[model samples]
Target: MTDAITLRESTPADIAFLQTLYPAAFPDEDLLPLVRSLLELPDVLSLLALARGVPAGHAVFTPGTVGGHAAPVALLGPVAVLPRHQCQGIGSTLIRGGRTRLEAAGTARLLVLGDPAYYGRHGFAATSDIRPPYDLPREWAPAWQSLSLGGDDAPMNGTLRVPGPWCNPALWA
Candidate 1:
């Protein structure tokens, strides 16, 4: 915790705010459709980081399964913070808060396709031996990371299956 950023579960009303926030944060990529679709997935955790009552950052964790295990797991991604709020600790706060909640709710591990450096600071590290069901671009091998979230520390050694909306081939590339 950062004292200024307030983290909370996003309400339906906050979707519009997130829609605007995503574009502002990622001007080149259109993440709005994915955000809208992920919101409908069961057991998805969508957290909002509000600075002074306005949305400053957002993160989402959704159900995912490893090919051979029943243990709970999640996929985290598309974490966004408004350009004006970037590097202000709002993104870190949202991630920490979401990780805590997910661990408490029994999530075993989390996987992400993101910058290794940024996610590594939050306890994520590159995983080998495990792979996504679809071929993630070869260059992204270093970016494919996983973290033990109150679960076994054993290497996650299987292909991953994420929610339908997240199955887009464009994302894997």
Candidate 2:
């Protein structure tokens, strides 16, 4: 039987685990620093998923704007699950929990560059109109999906910019 998974706001104690988990997903040195900067941003939302008191996965979301609307949208990314924990629904649990928290806080949208098959199960759909920043790969582009909590009319088209080091050409590329 699987142990219960718990989702919680990331604390300083979780930083070490995050550092370790990040490289597993994004091996690029530039990406790490950029991720670090995003985690430190005031508007960023960081979450950790644990199973039986051990870290299983992590997720980060940053504030963004879409289609000229300044709503509190999130750039979901760098979510990583421990290799041993894959297929156990730990990642999905974290995502659902995080979305619930963000929705409760009045967030209007959640955006991500990930697998359509995976994120789609969580209500994420690629926007026919929206586009991510120029630095992301085309494959990643196709994976750009959004979940609108503010009804179907929510704006999806617009530049999605990460709040910190992600803006740096060196880091973004």
Candidate 3:
């Protein structure tokens, strides 16, 4: 753990590590199927963080479209870090790294359904301009958030059109 953390785009070889890491990071959730599907997509960006050459954390960004936005849009989800790696800034590192890559690629907005406090610290704010694919619970409203990736200031308004894997209603809740 003394080695400086390094970031890299995830590869197929990293799937085994992700399978083990996801469950450990989210014991109550099964995110493997979604992760696997996202990896096979044509435009998804999956990032990996390594500490001392071992996988420390992973983050996935799936491309989507906000009806009115001419630029690119993406969703960040299921960001996972091993329990032992928690609070070491590995998760934050993965997030910022992914955003940096996406922004450079002309991605306009990044969406996430996660903890407001944690994501808020990373610049995600509750956005009324765009809506989630499925209706969110009243109390869970704040969990749906977005960050502008230096794309454009023009407001976008539309439901996020995600890939087939993320169409599951269960995941929306």
- The predictions' CA RMSDs to the true structure, in order, are 1.4, 2.6, 1.5
Model 2 accuracy (lDDT, Cα): 0.75
**Number of backbone collisions per candidate, in order?**
0, 0, 0
Residue-level lDDT of model 1, residues 36-56, one tens digit each, is 899988889999998877779
lDDT of 3 at 56: 87
What C-alpha lDDT, on a 0 to 100 scale, does residue 88 get in candidate 1? Answer: 84
- Candidate structures ordered by TM-score, highest first: 3, 1, 2
Deviation (Å) of 83 in candidate 3: 0.8
Model 3 C-alpha lDDT versus the unseen true structure: 0.89
Give the lDDT of residue 25 in candidate 3: 94
In model 3, the runs with Cα more than 4 Å from the true position are 1-3
Q: In candidate 2, what residue range of length 10 has the lowest lDDT sum?
A: 164-173
- Cα-based lDDT at residue 32, candidate 3: 96
Candidate 3: tens digits of C-alpha lDDT, residues 1-173: 43478899998999889989999998998889988988988888888999878898999999999976677899998799889988888888888899899989989899999999899999999987789999999999898999999756668899999897899898897
Residue 134, candidate 1: Cα error in Å is 1.3
**Which of the numbered candidates is closest to the native, going by highest lDDT?**
3
